[model samples]
Target: MEPPDFVRFGRAICCDLVQASRREWWLADGLGGYAGGTIAQCLTRRYHGLLIAPANPPLGRFLVFVKADATLHDNERNWPLFTNCWGSGAVEPQGLVHIESFRLDGSIPVWRFAIGDLILEQCIWMEREQHTTCIAWRLANAVERPVHLGIDLLVNSRNHHADTRPYGFNSIIEGNVNRISIGRAGGPTLHFHTDDGQLFARHQWIEDFDLPRERERGLPDRDSHFCAAHMRLPLRTEWSGLVATMSTTPEAPATDSPLRCGEMLNRRRAHDAARLTAAVTLTPELHDAPCWVRQLVIAADSFPIVQPVSAKETKKELNEKEQDRQGRFGQRKESVIAGYPWFGDWTRDTMIALPGLMLTTGRYASARNILTTLAGFVDRGMVPNMFPDDGGQPQYNTVDGALWYFEAWRAYIAVSNDVAALREIYPLLQEMVSWHLRGTRHRIGVDASDGLLSAGDSGIQLTWMDAKLGDWVVTPRHGKPVEVNALWFNALMCMAEFSRLLKKDAEIFETLAKQAKVGFSRFLKPAGGLYDVLDGPEGNDDSIRPNQILAVTLHYSPLTPQAQAKVVAETGRHLFTSYGLRSLAPEHPGYRGRYEGGVWERDSAYHQGPVWSWLLPHFAMAEYRVTGDAELAQSRLAPIHDHLLDAGLGTISEIFDGEPPHSPRGAPSQAWSVACILAAWVTLERARPSAREGMAKKEESRQ
Candidate 1:
C-alpha cells in the first residue's frame, strides 16, 4: 500500500533537539483515549503518554502507560533509543541525535533513527473504539548478527488532569514471559503484550521527571511513574513491538492477539485507508483536495465519540412516533470533544464545529446525533456550555451555545435535507427560543425595550471569550454581547425558515426576527463597525474584536450590505493575522499580546489578544460576502494549510500568541480550529465562479 502524504520533517528539524521537541504528534482512539509525544520521543508535558484511556467510558480518564524507554544493546555497548528530560534542566541520553527523519503516515507517527548501518523505525497508534495503543519498532535496513534491545515499561494510574505523585497508586505488577499486568486494587488494570519479548517484573519508582511544557504553563513540572516491568526483545527486518490496553472485557487484549507485528501495523494502515476512502465516497470533492486538507479530514474523525444516552430518559417525554424515530437512530449519541488532552465535550465547540467536522466531511449521521443529543439536555432554553469531565451534570453557562445550536441545525438540514429529523428537532429548537424570549439561567434573556439578547451576570463569563481565574471573570461581556445578538437575530430568521418549511405559522418568527434586526442596529458604532458590547456595566464597549465579524458571516446577517462591508474592512485591518484573527486588537488597552505565564496571567490573556483559528472561518465567510472575491477570501486560509505541519502534526492548534511568530498555545489539536478552517475552505471552493462573476458585473456597472 502506498503511504499517505501529510507531513514530513528531515534531519534539519529532527536533528535539532529544540525544533524536534517543540513539534508534537497526536493520535486518538475515538473513545476519548489518545497517545502523544514530541518528535524527540521525550515527555515534555504531564499529558504526554503512550496510553491514556477513560476509566469511566468516555470520562474519568487515567494515564495507564507512560513510556517505554528503549535501549539498543549490541554486544557490550548500549545505546539509549529514547529521550528523557530530568528535573535539573538536563536532557539525558540525547536520543534525538540518532534521529534521521520523522513523518506522519496517515494518523500514525513514524520516526526513523539512523545508527551506523542499521536504521530503526518507531511508530505509535491507537485502535479505533478501543482503549488499545500499539507501539512498534522495525529495522528499516538489514543488520548483520542479532540485535538485542531492553525496554523499561513505565505505567501510571491517576487522573489525567492531575500532576503525577510518587506512589500515586500502589501498583501491583504481574508478568510472565511475554505478558505484563499493572494496576492497584479496584482500579482498571493495563495489560501489556509483546509479539516477541520476555517480560520481567520490576516495580521501581522513577521520580523528578521534568515536564518543560507544564512548567511553561506554570503548572506542576515534576512527575513520577512506576517502572512496572522490563522487557528484553529482539529486532528483525520486518516489525516487532508491544501493545498496551485497558480493556478487561470478554474480548480483552484482542487487538494484538495474533501476535504478529506486521499484521498489527497493517490493520492500522487499513483502518486509516478506509477512513480516507469513506470520506471521498461521501464527499467526492475531497478526492481532489490537497494532501493537507485530506489529512484534516482524517483528523476530523478523532473528535466525535460515542456517548450512550438512556432510552428511558430520552423517550420519557416524547410521543410514540418520536420514540420510534429515536429508536431507529439508536440510543448512542456522539459528541465532539472540544480539544484533546484536556477539554471535554463542550456544547459551544460541538455546535460551532458540527458543520465543518461532520457536514463538510459527509458524516451526516454523526452530526444529527450530536444535535439531537444536546437538544435533549437543553434546559431553560439554554444548551449546555460544557459537560463535566467526571461525567457529571452538564453546565449551562454560555449564552451563545444555544444560539449556535440554531445555526448547527440550519447547516445540517442544508446538507442532509432530512425533513423528518428536522420535524422531530424543530419543536425543541422552538422551545429553546421560547426560553430565551422569556428568561433563562445566567441572566440570559432578550431585552424587552431593544428586542436584543442580553446575557451574563457578575462573575459569570457567558460568551465564548470566557476565561476565568478564581472568582475573576476575564472578558466580562455581561450585556448585549455582539455575537450573541448576531446569533439571536440569525436564530430567529432560521426559525422563520424552518417554520415555513414545516408548513407551520412563520409570521410570528418573521416578526420576531424583524424586531431583532432593528434592535441589532444598536450595536453599530457611529465610527464604523459594531460595538463589542452594548449597555454593559460601563456602557457600550467600542473595543474592536472578532465578534463583530459574525454579524456579517452568519446565514441571516442583520447588517446591511454597506454596514457588512465596513465591519469586514475594519476587522481585516485591525484583527487579521496570518493564522487567524486576534481576540482583541493591539490598539485596545486591555489587549494582552502574549498568552503565557501562570493561571491568572494566561487566563487574563486568553481572550484579550490571542489569535483564534476557529474565527478564521467567520472572517473568511464575511470577507467573501463583502468582496465577492472567492480567491482573495480563500487566500486568507493559506497559512493554516502550512500550519498542519507545525505544532500539531496534521491538526490545528486551539490558539496562537497574539504577537509575531504566533507561537501555538492551548490544546494542540482543537476541534473547531480544524473544523472551521476546512469548512470555510470548502465553502469558498463551492462559491467560485459565481462569486467571481458577481464581482465582474459590479466592475462593469461601475465603469
Candidate 2:
C-alpha cells in the first residue's frame, strides 16, 4: 500500500522538502534555509532568489542563490541582495559557486550555483565525517507564478536569544561593491554597489558556537529582529520538483571505504523521492464549506504531489482513526504522512498541531504517537517546548506549553474517552503544576496570596508579546498576567476533571477546584471587570487585554457567568482589532500603530499594539459562550477565518499590526493560531441549543 498523502498527515499551511542527510529543507515558498538543532536560520536576506543551501555540516554554513535577468533589473538603481552572515567568515568566488568559510569551525565551505534568464540551479554540499546532507534547487523562469516564501525568522529567534543573550548575526553583502546602504523601503530592503561583472557571497556564523556560553551571556540589549528571506521563482516546467539528497556513514561497510555517488544517491532517493514529490501536492482547502467542516480536502493537482494511504495497513488504520477522533473535536488537518517530506524539529508545534491536523481528521493512533513522543520528553514533569534540530537537549522556556499539553490531553480524552492515558499522565500533570507553583526558570511562580500564577519580569517573555528590545520588555506585565491566571484556573479545573475521570483522589480534585474558584473570585476587579494583571502585592493595574477570554472558552473555567460576560464585553470594546485582538489596548501608552518597517520598529509594534491572529479563536469562543450569539460570534470570526484563508491559505499567521485592516507579521504557518481556529471551528459546528436560543433571543430583543 502507498504511504498516506502529505495533506492527510496534519493541517499545515505550508510544507517543507527536507534533505535530512544534507540537513536542509526547502519551504513550499521559494526560499530555502538551514535546519539547525532548535533553530532554522534563513540563508537569503531577500526574496529575489529561488534557491538556498546549507553549505556546511550541522547547518553552520549557509548560502542563497538567485537567478537574475536584465528585464527584472532596474538600470537607475543597483539591486542589492542581503545575506545574513554571522560569526567570523570570509567569502570568495569559486568556479560556478561561492565558497564561504570559517576555518576553526569547518562549517560552511561551498555554495555553488548557476543562474540564467529562465532557469536557476543551486547546490549545497557539507561533509561531517561520513554523514552528508545536500540540497539542490531548480526553479522555473515564469514570472506569473505565485511566490512561495516565509518571513520573520529573526522574531522567532527572539525567545531563544532572550534566554541565551547573545549577539545576533547581521547582514553583509560581498562583491566588488564599494558602498552598501541599509534602510526601510515599503518593506525592509538593503541597497549596495552592483556592477555587471560583480560576484559576491554572504554568510552569518557565530564567533563562539557554544550553547552554554550563549545562555550564560543572558539577555543582550539588541538581538536579531525583523529578519526575513523570500524567493520568487517563475514556474515554467510542468514537472518541477525539489530534490534532497542525504547519506550517513554506515557503522561497518562491507568494502573498506564508505558508499559514494550512485549507490548513496540511489538509496537516499528511493526513500525521499516520493516525499519530495508529495510535499507539493498536499496543499489544504481554503473554503469554509460544510464539507470542510468535517475535514479539509487537498487538491490532487496541487504543486507538490501526495500519495494515498490504504486502510488495510495497521499503521494506516491507526492514523485514520486518530484523524477521525480529531475531526470530532474539530481538528481535521493532515500531518505526519508516511514517506512525506518533513522538518526534523518543531516537536512542540507537531504535538500541539496533532489533534486538529491528525486526530480530528481520523488518525487516532498517530495522535497517540505524537502525544507519546512529547510525553517521552517529560523531564521533571516538563514536556519540551522545542527540540534542537541537531538532536541536542530540548528547551522548555514556554510557560503555556504545559498548559497546552493539558488541553491536548483533554482533547484526546474528548475523542477517545480513554481513562488509561489520563491515569498515566496524571502524575506528570501533577508534577507540572507543582513545578509551576514552586517556580521554574525566569521567575514563573504561583502566588501563595492568591492561586493566580505569576510569570515574566525575568527578561524572558514566555507568553506571546515575546519580543524584547534592548533592555525594554515589549509588553512587560511583570506580575500576574491575566492569561496566566486564566490558564492556571483552567489547569486546575482540568486536573480536577481528569482526576474524576480516572477515579483517583476525589478529595484532592475537590480541593483544587475550590482553590481555583477562590482564585478566580479574588482576581476580579470592581470597575475594570477582569483586570489584565494583579502585579506585586496589590491587585491594582486593571489593563483591558484579551487574555481574560480563556477563562470562558476552556472546557472548565472558574469564572462565574457574570464575570465571564464582563470579560467578553470589555475585551470586545477595548482590545478587538479588525484582524484580531491587540496584545495591548490603544489606550495604553506603549501602543504603536504601524507594524512594518525596520527591525526595532516592527518588534516595537509586535505585542505592544499588534493584533495576534492566534487570539481570534480564543476571543470568538469567549464571545460566543458569554453572549450565546452564534451569529454574532460567527460574524466576528468570519473576517478572521476569511483573512487566514485568503492571506495564509489553510493556515493562520502569527500576528498582525493592530492598526486598520491589520497587516500580517511573523511566520505564515503558526501552530497555536491554527489549533485555536480548529478548536473554535468545531465548537461553532457543535453549537449548543442554549447558544442558539440565546442568539434567537438577542435577535428578538433587537427586533
Candidate 3:
C-alpha cells in the first residue's frame, strides 16, 4: 500500500543499462502535453523528451526542449549523467553507471547521480496547465572543489511523431541575456532561463538518435535535434543547485523555497484523491483504500481534458427561437482522450470511459459536459464514432456509441440526482430511440421481427472490433452482434427507468425492452454459451468470444442467473489469462494467436486473439454476480498490479499479446483500460463484507 514497487527500480537495477533503459516515466502538463524518458536517462521513443507541448492547446504537438545532456565534473575526471543511443547500436557515455537511484515522487520523476564524493539529484516536472518544464538540480553532498556542470541545450521544432533530418534549419542565439530566446525565422520563440549558469553559443546537428519503441512500431528508428546553446553551472557547496526552465514566456526566478514544484504536483494529486473519496461517501468502509487505488485515481485525471467546441459550430447563425434555447448549453465542451502518443478522442472510448474517469473521480461538471457535448453531435439517432484531431466534422459510423449514451446518462443521473438536466435532454433521448427503431446509418436499426439491433454493411466496420486496412475489414462482424443487443436492451430499460424518474409515460420503452429480451433468447448457444452473432450473412457465429460476458455484467441483463453462470464459466475455461480475457478462443479455427508486425498485420489480429484489459472488468463483475464472492472476483485483477511497474508506470495498457506470458502492446496508456480497472477495484471495495457489516452496525445503533 506504501506505493508498492511502482516506484519500479530497486538498488540492483540502478546500474543495469539494459533493464533501466526499458522502463520509462511520464509527466503530464494537464493540457494534452507531456514529457517522459527512460529510467536510464536515455531516449527510446520519439515521444520521450523534456518538453512535448501542444502549440494549439491539444493539437499541433511539437517537441521543443529535447534534452539537457548533463555532464558531471569531479576532481580530475568528467562523468556523463546523460545516456545516449546511436543508430550504430552503441550506447555512448554509459551514464547509468553513475549508480544512484530513480523514483517517482507522486507524478514527478527524480533521478540521483552519485560520483566519487559528490551526489547530484535532478528532478523534471511541468507547471500545472502550462507548457513550461522545470529541470532542477541540487547538490546532495558538498563539492569541496567547485564542480563544473556542463549542459547542452538541444531543441526541436517539428511534429513529435515525425523524425527531424536536418535540412539546414538553424537558430540564432543572442548570448546570455536575462533569458536567451531560441528560434528560427517566423517560428515560435522558446525562452531558456537559468539561475546560475553561463551560456555559450553553439550550433550542431545531433543525428542518428536511435528510438527502439519506434522500431517496434515499424517506423523510422532514427531522429535528430539541434544543440542551440550550452550552459555551465558551478557548484562549490552543499544544497546549492541550478534550475533551468523552458517555457513560452520566461518564468521569473522562484523567490520562495525551490521545493514548490514537486510539492505542488503532490498537492494536486492529494486534492484529486480527496475528491474521489468524497464521491464515494456512500461506502465509508472503502474510504481508506490501498495506495495503488489512489495512484489510479491520480492517473485517471490525465485523460479528461477541456475540449472547446469549434468556432464554426459555435458561431453559426441561428434563428431567434433557436438562440433562446442555445443559452442552456455553452461551447466549453469536455472529452476524454482515448490513449496517449497516438489516439485522439473517440466516441465509444469516451462513453466507455465516462464513469470511471470522470464520475468515479467526482468530476461531475466534466461528466455533464461530456454528455452534453455528445448530445450535440447526435445525428440520425447516432453519436459520432470519433471527432477528428484537426477539428473537422465528427464521424457517424458507430452503432454502439449512441446506445452507450443512454447508459452514461443513466449512471450520471442516478448519482447526481439532477433530474432537471435529464428533463432538458429527455426529448433528445426519445428522438434517438425513434431513429434507431426507424433505422439510421449502416442499416443500424431494430429488427422488426426480433426487436434486436442489427448493423454493418460491405467494406465498413461498425462494431468496436472494427479494424480495417484498405478495403480488407478484419473480423467483419456484419450483423446482429450479441453485445449490441445487450446494450440495446439495457438502453431501453434505462430509458424506461428515466421515464419513471421523470414522471412520464414509459410503456413504449418497457414493451420494447421485453420484446428485445425475448429476441435475445436466440443467441444462447446449445453448448451453454452465447453466440458471437446471429442473423448474419454467414448465419449463426458461435465463436465463443468475450462479448457475451457483457450480458451478465451490465446493469440490465437479458440472461437468467443460470445462463449468466454458463457464460462466465465458458469465458473462464478458454479465454481467461492473467492479464485479461483473449479476444478469440484459442481453439477457434481462424484465431490469430499473437499480435505483431505492421498496421495490416497487427490489425488482422487486433480482435482475432489480442487480450484487452478493459474487458477484465466485465468478467470480474460477472464472476462476482455468479459466485457472490468479492475476494475471488478481485483476485481476477491481481496480475495488473505487476503490470503497473512496467510499460506505463501507474497505469494500464490498451492490449496484450494473446499468448502465454502476455506482453503488453498497443497504446502504453489507455482511457478505458484504466477506467475499467479502477471501476473493478471500487466494485470489490464496495462489496467487501466489512462494508456490509459496518452498515448493519450503524443501522442497529440508530435503532
The candidate that wins on TM-score is 1
Cα lDDT tens digits, model 2, 1-703, are 1222221111121111111111222222111132221001222122212322222222211222222211112224322211232323322111112111111001111121223333432233222222223322233454443322111112112111122233343443322322222222121223222111122333332222222212222322222232222222222223221222211221211222344322433443343334323322321211223322222212111111111111112122235644444343332112221111122234444544556554444445556555654554555445555544333456666666677677777777777877876776677688888888788876777777766677765566566446778877666666776666766667777887887787666666467557756876766888646776677445456766677777777777778888888888888888887667887789988777666665677766676777876678778878888877765675665665445233233345667778886766555445555555665665664475655576567559979
Best model per lDDT: 1
* Ranking of all predicted structures according to TM-score, beginning with the best and ending with the worst: 1, 3, 2
Model 1 misplaced regions, further than 4 Å: 1-3, 248-259, 308-329, 690-703
* 1 or 3, greater by lDDT: 1
In candidate 1, which residue pairs clash?
A: none
Judge candidate 1 against the unseen true structure and give its global Cα lDDT, from 0 to 1: 0.85
Model 2, position 72, has a per-residue lDDT of: 18
Candidate 2 TM-score over all chains jointly:
0.57
Q: For residues 222-272, could you state the per-residue lDDT of candidate 1 as single tens digits?
A: 999989999898988788888888953323355535647778788888888
What TM-score against the true fold does each predicted structure earn? 0.94, 0.57, 0.92
Backbone clashes in model 2: 49
Winner of 2 and 3 under lDDT: 3
Q: How far is candidate 1 from the true structure (C-alpha RMSD, Å)?
A: 4.3
Tell me how far the alpha carbon of residue 483 in candidate 3 is from the true structure, in angstroms, after superposition: 1.0
Least accurate 10 contiguous residues by lDDT in model 1: 307-316
lDDT of 3: 0.78
